[model samples]
Target: MRRYGQAVLMLLVGAAVLRISLFSALYLRYVQSGLRPYLIASGALLVLLGVAAGVRAAREVPDEDETQDPHEHGHTHTTGPRLAWLLALPAAALLLFPPPALGSYSADREDAQRAAQGIGTFPPLPSGDPVDLSVAAFTSRAVYDSDRSLKGRTVRLTGFVTHGDDGTWYITRLLVSCCAADATTSKVEVRGADAPATDTWVTATGIWHPKGRLGSSAAWPPLLDAKAVRRVEEPSNPYEQR
Candidate 1:
């Protein structure tokens, strides 16, 4: 039972790694920004514990007089062989078929929200080169005012789709603090084009135009000129890439 437990735990760890690697949003929140260092530290601790458990299990052996049947004792007392095979379950899952990215399923999940205090006002760009702004920035500004400063500026954002209302499509980028357990959602309402498939990664280059009012929430009223739009693979570290 101990061996089985260890095996199951190891498999869970492997699945987590697979999910984080393949899914960009998960990678950004949990592995990139805030919780990255802690995850590394925790990973090291887990490795040490696994090693200690393995060593102790290895040293444990049944006495000759303890069992009447040699075969039963042989199978029950040996730990390495039993636990070693369990690793293959995760390995096979990874190799044979990996999970897909977080898709439109989480569109309505309201994990994305901006910080009220720390997120300062959007600064004016030099207006020389194309300005780079995150979806978080746009969402923050939309809460306070619905101005056109963000209009006609080239903006870059990556996230999954949340929903579409009227002619606008709502997209979201998830910010994870630790594991998927503590993920927050930041959203952008895109206009001037038909909504892309929900939960797919996209780079939208457009001019920001303030449109209608959101709910009792802040006013985000911004539209993308949508000069260009294309789908891309989710990056290894999918958050702001900061």
Candidate 2:
């Protein structure tokens, strides 16, 4: 712990970063895609620094003139190094078992913070049946669009499932402006379909079930009358960009 503790910690952290950002798409769980280059660079630099430190430590020699007294040697000052090793635990976890993207727990926490967006007119959606749309896009249109853009349209939305307090289920995706810390939930109430397991990714094809006037609270957590629901693999990037 004394000789190479810092080096080992740095290597562990750098390897963790590389595991998530450079070697795979797991970084998407924590940050926006645009930050990948920065993360990769930072991870590479840490690895290089760790390697250099290890080499320097390996070539070091104990100071013969600065011998410790036997009384002090038996009660050494190893506490700091021991505590420092604790920092490596999270890094090791990240490298071995990266965490999943934000899910129902995060979504539920946003219940009180879901602000109502101002109403506006949106551009007409592309002409097609069962048009694919992100959960955030669909939610915005269903709640705020003055023209009721989602009316009469068969849209497909994909997200993990989250249960409500009243036994209802939603297709929910987190919306991130930068990273998971600032992520907001975008969910749609699904009717006419049985819910999959919580946190299970799924694609729902449905038409908007209008509840109230646009720009009103009653219109939110926009309703979807699902015609079909199919289980799907979670996307590499689970969050919708804001």
Write the residue-wise lDDT of candidate 2 on 1-242 in tens digits. 35787898889999999999999999999999999999999999999999999988878884542356536656555476679889989999999999888899999888733345688899999999999999999988988888988889999999999998798999999999999999998999999999899999999999999987777777778999999999999999999999
Cα lDDT listed for each candidate: 0.56, 0.89
**Candidate 1 segments whose C-alpha is farther than 4 A from its true place:** 1-29, 33-38, 63-103, 111-121, 145-148, 165-167, 177-179, 212-218, 240-242
Task: Give the per-residue lDDT digits (tens) of candidate 1, residues 1-242.
Answer: 44445644554564455445444335453444565555545545655665666666567774454435647655545566666667667745653455553445544555333334433345665565356667766666555443435655677666665565555676566555444455455677776666777667777767666554532234443455666667877766554432
Instruction: Please name the candidate that would achieve the greatest lDDT relative to the true structure.
Output: 2
Error of 1 at 67 (Å): 2.8
lDDT of 2 at 142: 87
